[model samples]
Target: MAVSFVQRRFMSNALQKWAYNLSGFNKLGLMRDDCLYENDDVKEALRRLPQTVVDERNYRLIRAVQLSIQKDILPKEQWTKLEEDVMYLQPFLKEVKKEREEREAWNKQY
Candidate 1:
């Protein structure tokens, strides 16, 4: 079954938070003093991270974020910010899907 955009949005937010927490050790090595969750830039960067890094915990966080967005849990401006990040990724995802289909068709011939 196809997943809706809302589902994807939720997944993305959760994945981002999970990845952020998991990177704590890595952050230590980098010697950054800023807290991951408190920093807007850090959070934004995580939100933009690729799907390959997303894990279960983060997936859940994203779902929560999506639910919050849908229910107006956060302020309207904050929700808009989240939407902006998701919008940025739409084109890239489309390209990836197109390539996957091409690859699948080529394999079918053999």
Candidate 2:
């Protein structure tokens, strides 16, 4: 028996979400994507985001940093809720990765 794509994705997302909450970055007003290291793919994704989104991401990071230095997290009311912490950069990253893979595959065809 083989697991289906949707099922696999669902399980993977569940685990990811569980890990995200367990990591507690969201408690400090940081999204899961914010915790991602600044790799080339993430940089590309950030470049593709709209100005407003970029500003918001910056604000979140700054706030998180301030909270860390102060030895506190955002107030419970200010903490990023799990449902609200969407993967804003993931779609763009996926697109960038797909393009990279396609380019690699194309180059190999020569």
Judging by lDDT against the true structure, name the best candidate: 2
TM-score per candidate, chains pooled = 0.31, 0.79
Estimate, for each residue in 48-88, the C-alpha lDDT of model 1 and write its tens digit: 55665435336435655576567634333333232222333
Please identify model 1 stretches exceeding 4 Å from their true place.
Answer: 1-72, 81-86
Candidate 2: where is the Cα deviation over 4 Å? 1-20
Give each model's whole-structure lDDT: 0.47, 0.89
Per-model clash counts, in order, read 9, 0
Which candidate number maximizes TM-score?
Answer: 2
Which run of 10 residues does model 1 get worst, by summed lDDT? 26-35
Model 2 lDDT per residue over 1-110, tens place: 99999999999989977886788898889988898989888899899999999999999999889988999977779878777888999999999999989999999998
